[model samples]
Target: MSVTTTLRPPATNATAFVPSLGIALASAAAFGSSGPFAKSLLEAGWSPGAAVTARIGIAALVLLPVALVMLRGRWHLLRRNAGLLIAYGVVAVAAVQLAFFSAVQTLSVGVALLLEYLGVVLVVLWLWLRHGQRPRRWTVAGIALAVAGLVLVLDVLGGMRVDGVGVLWALGAAVGLAAYFVLSARDDTGLPPLVMATGGLVVGALALGVAGLVGVVPMTVTAADVDLAGLTLPWWVPVATLSLVAAAFAYASGVSATRPLGSKVAGFVGLTEVLFSLLFAWLLLGELPLPVQLLGGVLVVAGVVAVRYDELTAPREPDPAPSLTPEAPAPPR
Candidate 1:
């Protein structure tokens, strides 16, 4: 069997650009809802570790068949990029969930998210350092404004004391997430996104399973007391959905989209996840941010815009070949 991979060429046409934006927005929406939904599970008495483990474990299972079908003709790529793929799943997907859950247990969902958005600025820095081009002055200014806005959003100065270990975990999530984008953009040796997606979740699930077995995290589940809108449910159901849909679909789509949207562009656009989460919370839980947090939210958007203004304004790169020539080869020397 043969396999084909789609590499993300920069989008130049109006049609392509619009679809990328829509995909990115949809991904953000799915990811944003994860927090509140996960919170419900935790409130139902699932420990953070167990909840996170279940979410990824189930997601891995859901994705396995898809990966198998996609990689059926080309299993060799898995061996080729095994290390990078596994790292992406473990660090980016698994670590982010565990950290965010811990953060939300102590901090409000909005506040925890506001801190995680720091990854945007971190991505800007990563691009600058890795590529030797300074982010535009506007981008710098936006990052500053956004960070300041996050302080306001998080109310870091208003006697907000973060849990030390939790804070560390959240920071780790940021680092892992940034690496995820950078690495996902690298070639996966022509593996399909489904294959890459499956491979990552498998590695993450295995690692989490081992941790559970070693007593680092408890794997046992028992029914807990909780009621939701007149529905009786096991505590694991919500967390499991979070893992399979929110985290799995979200991560796979987000990672796969990197091929169509460059890493830097994807990072900037992903800021929408915060807004989506806020909207979900408002609608689902009737939870509204305080007036101060609202202002902070605006700053976050402004900051992201400022940071990304250059790419938004810069001319798109030209396509190398005509679409009609599907088998276009490298120009002869």
Candidate 2:
């Protein structure tokens, strides 16, 4: 099997540009809803592990047909990319959600999302260290600003305190999120985004199921009503929304967007999910952002912009063809 496959480069033409941006934004919006929806489930007595498992499991079933069609008898691709798919499932789908949902149990949705998005900075660091691609001055400045924003988000000096366990879980989510981007960027796999999304979700769901069976993480659910936007609703309402819109559409659109936007741009674009998460959290959970935290969010977005600008303007070198030796893999958003 080839270690590297030729991945699609970022789109530059107007025709491809507008649609990709639109899809990416839509993906962000869809994904943003997950935080509030999952929080509602948590309030209703659903364990983080159970909620995440159901979300991925349902999404996998929803996308299975499309993935199979895309395969078109190309079964060997799955075997060839088994490692990549497994990593995507374990880290991106299962672990990321487990950590994020655990954090949201104590942290507000927006703050939890902000923490997970620290993955963007981690991605930059990974590229710098692993690929030996030193960041330019703007990138360095961006990292500094992002770190400052993180401190304010945490409110380290303020009397207000976030749960220590929540902080740790959110940081774990950040690492998983970074893995998602790094894995998704590997274009040499010859695997379509839909296939990867489907496979990862299935694998992740199974892994979570096993964990639940063994009681590593509590798995619980309730049939009680859920509160959303000041309205009482059936439990199924949020679960359906989370599974279909948030997980299925979000992952599909996100993977497609990455193909045209490139992982770096796509990752930064995903920061919009934090803003949307804040809105949903306020509306659905009544958790509004603090003024200082909002300011910190602005700084975080600014930092991402600085880093993206540096990437866009930096001189480029032609990429060499990917080698066919087995090596590490990457993930999706």
Identify the candidate with maximal lDDT. Answer: 2
Q: Report the poorest 10 consecutive residues by lDDT, candidate 1.
A: 1-10
The sequence of per-residue lDDT tens digits that candidate 2 reaches over residues 78-182 is 998998888888988899988887887788654676678888878777766767667799888877777676556545456434788998999999998987777
Residue pairs in candidate 1 whose N, alpha carbon or C atoms collide under 3 angstroms: 8-259, 55-243, 139-307
lDDT of 1 by residue, 1-333 (tens): 222222343454567666776777677778877766666766676677777777777888888887888778777887877776777677767766667766766765545665676777676687677665467877778777777777766566664656767677667667766766666665546867666767777887787788778887665454784444345666666766687678778768876676567666677667767667767777767777667867877887787567556666665558786677577788989
Native RMSD of candidate 1 (Å): 5.9
Give per-residue lDDT, candidate 2, residue 48: 78
